[model samples]
Target: MKTFDHLSVIGLREWIGLPELGIDRVRAKVDSGAKTSALHASDIVTFYRDGETWVRFKAHTGTRRHPRDVECEARLVSFRRVRSSNGQLQERHVIRTDLVLGDQRWPVDFTLTCRESMRYRVLLGCSAMLDGQLVINPGQRFVQGFPQTDRTLRG
Candidate 1:
């Protein structure tokens, strides 16, 4: 048997954090099949920030029965035409943000779109794991545990 100790093992689902956007906790579906990550967003609007494009939207981070909204604003990376899992082509707003999963934190690009019908609000795609830093265990869940956050001051 061979092992890659340099890679972090993550399950099909994990808890993650987007500190720059003030997101303390959110469930994400780790999908290597997905080329790009996505976030469930609504009321998406674009504006100019110092002559650069910026986006503002409301992200749904909770279940449909218990909805939680988080207002987020980020510099627009670009508008990408993506084919959804259902085979629908649509233009989506892309934004770069730091993703915190367990002890590892790194920048990731996420496409903002409506995923109301999906089970998970966030999707961690293959591009975010392209650096060969992670190995996904399909049969497991939450292998990295909950993402560490500084929400509570350590004393």
Candidate 2:
């Protein structure tokens, strides 16, 4: 047996927080196969803020039966042409924001796209786990538990 003492172990599905976007507890699906993380966003609009491009969109954060919508705005990182899971290419709006998982918090880039049919609102891809801080346990779920609201964990 091997131990990754320096890395935190998380399950396939975990509760995450996007503090910058006012998202406190959104379920995220950890996908090691994907290179970029994605957020379920709709009604995406771009505007100028201080001469820089910014994006505003509505995020669906809840389950299908009990839907929750959060209107969010973030600075546009770039437009990326990414291939979807179904082998379709599409241009997506990219934004960088802080992601809070359990006691750890860090900046993670997420591509904005409509994922109305997906179960999870946020997709945690390989890029988000590339810092060598996370190791996923495919057989488990919510290993890190829900993110705390404490200010100290906001880092």
lDDT string for model 2 (91-142, tens) is 9999999999998889999999988898898999998987638999899999
Top lDDT hit: 2
lDDT (Cα atoms) of all candidates against the true structure: 0.91, 0.91
| Model 1 spans > 4 angstroms off | 152-155
Q: State the lDDT of candidate 1 residue by residue for 85-124, as single tens digits.
A: 8999999999999998887889999999999999999999
Clashing pairs in 2: none
Index of the highest-TM-score prediction: 1
lDDT of 2 at 71: 97
TM-score, candidate 2, is: 0.94
Displacement of the residue 142 alpha carbon in candidate 1, Å: 0.6
The per-residue C-alpha lDDT of model 2 at residue 43 equals 96
